[model samples]
Target: MNSNNEGKMDVLNNIDDQFKELLELIEKEKVSSFSMKHFDRLKKKRKTSKKKWFIIGFLILTLISMYFILLNEQLTYNIYFVFLSFVRLILIKKCVNTTEIIKQSNITFFNFTKSIYLNHLPVIIDDATDSWPAMKELTLKKLFQLFIEDPVLAENDLCYFETNIRNYNQAEGADRLFNDYINGKRRSFIGQWNNCKRETLKVIRSYYNKPYFLPPSVTQTLMGNWFLVSAGFHKGTDYLHRIPLNYDWVWLAQIQGSSLIELRPKHPCETICSILKSVTLNKGDLSNDCFFLAKESYWTR
Candidate 1:
């Protein structure tokens, strides 16, 4: 009986040592970077419409003829003369109007491209740490990528977005008017996510304009199944500010523990869930399943 008891004790000691080794491994290797989705949407250029000189030349001629010849026509006297006069007047307007339109479009496009380029983050190896300014640019980039990709999954990520957004197939400079509208409101909406996600191409980088925050409204709009990210026992303060991200109701997993764990819902939707899905929670203070996994890592004692 003594020998049996001693053998069991040795087995238990070995098990404890193994557990410690496993814990050490988790501490060293748990950090992850986002590499699952190979985003290439940004590579495809949204072709810009070029200036149509033919239209401009035609407009010039129309205005010249209208100003010199049609201006003196008797008012509403001959139907043909009246029509020519109207055509010339319209041509002049088109020429002047397209000028502003083209300029605004180019500006809006420039800002729009910048906003998209900064969204994808090269996933970092140490995932558990982040500060507002420390992760500012990286956060902005990752959020932008996520913003575009989510839209693609929903199908609205491919349309061109702008002030007077012309149909993608249009040639008569329809984009002119659209570009004008967007630039006119640049600071308020150009590198915007909520307004553009629904109308943009998938994962085209629409979230980096502001580094500290991702749009909560986008997540709030989701209606299907989702995973809820919890901060576990850690109540939010500045570090958990990312929790309020607006996503749809998701499934929940509760974590509990002492402290030191710095991960939580990066948005409100990351926390707000419709149902309690599954939990990787353990018997300690700091823990996370930031990744969706069945098996969990946590303290037993």
Candidate 2:
């Protein structure tokens, strides 16, 4: 009788253990459900906030543009006001899941103005650099040689370059960077030689003329050009460099080598559209690859 009573007690304890485990499992599931619901609510709230701000900003800009148009009686001012209104309307109305990098083998000025300027899209103009003397007569080795010959460039002329793990946003002498690259000291730094002196700019222009497809107004602007140079690296590598954002229209002409260019929408458009659109700029049959970016287009290389 005693043994039988002990067995009964053991069964009761086993049942209690099972019940406790079941309760714990239910509690865990409830906590998981609560967490997921909270995360979703936060996500929705953030998205809604972004959308509200975008609308508010757009309305403010529209009012400002209209005010300017009313204040100025000039025909040009009125036309600009109208154009900006139309562009903003398109920006607000369109919601695209994915964006593309359009390639045009032979893009005319009107088409360029329509697609890139008015529509504010990113475009690649293929064979666009065929007319450039740099395409025909210049080589990367020759370009380096020219830089070496220039005293300003060979000595103290400053150039922006990508820093390694220790530093970012660095500028160093072009000569030193080139020397390190040549002597196997450091080949990882990618340099951008921009804002050249007048003499240096003159030398550069001799090799490349203004793109023929640009509107007359665009060509007249002296915003200058940027020369991006790096020892080639494979994609998905940390050694690759990033180009900075610009306020005005930006164009890149690939002198040598290819780059995977990725463009992101401006902050306001981020909620409505996809995050990134990429195009590979290659030196195909043409002398070089060329691409253009609207003033609002954000890009990285």
The most accurate candidate by TM-score is: 2
In order, candidate lDDTs are 0.28, 0.55
Candidate 2: which pairs clash? Answer: none
- Cα lDDT tens digits, model 2, 164-183, are 32343445445555555556
Which of the numbered candidates is closest to the native, going by highest lDDT? Answer: 2
**Candidate 2 deviant stretches above 4 angstroms:** 1-98, 151-156, 163-173, 180-189, 196-199, 235-242, 284-301
Consecutive 10-residue window with the lowest summed lDDT within model 1: 97-106
Model 1: residues >4 Å from true position, as ranges?
1-155, 158-185, 189-301
lDDT of 1 at 262: 32
Q: Write the per-residue lDDT of candidate 1 for residues 1-301, one digit (tens) a residue.
A: 9999999999999999999999987765543222222223322322222245667888999889756543433221244323433443343322221111011111232342223212111111121212222223322223333433454534443222222122322442323323433345212112111223423321222221111122221121211111122222233223221222232111121222222223232222133312223223322211212111111112111
RMSD of each: 38.5, 25.0
lDDT of 1 at 202: 19
lDDT over C-alpha atoms for residue 201 of model 2: 53
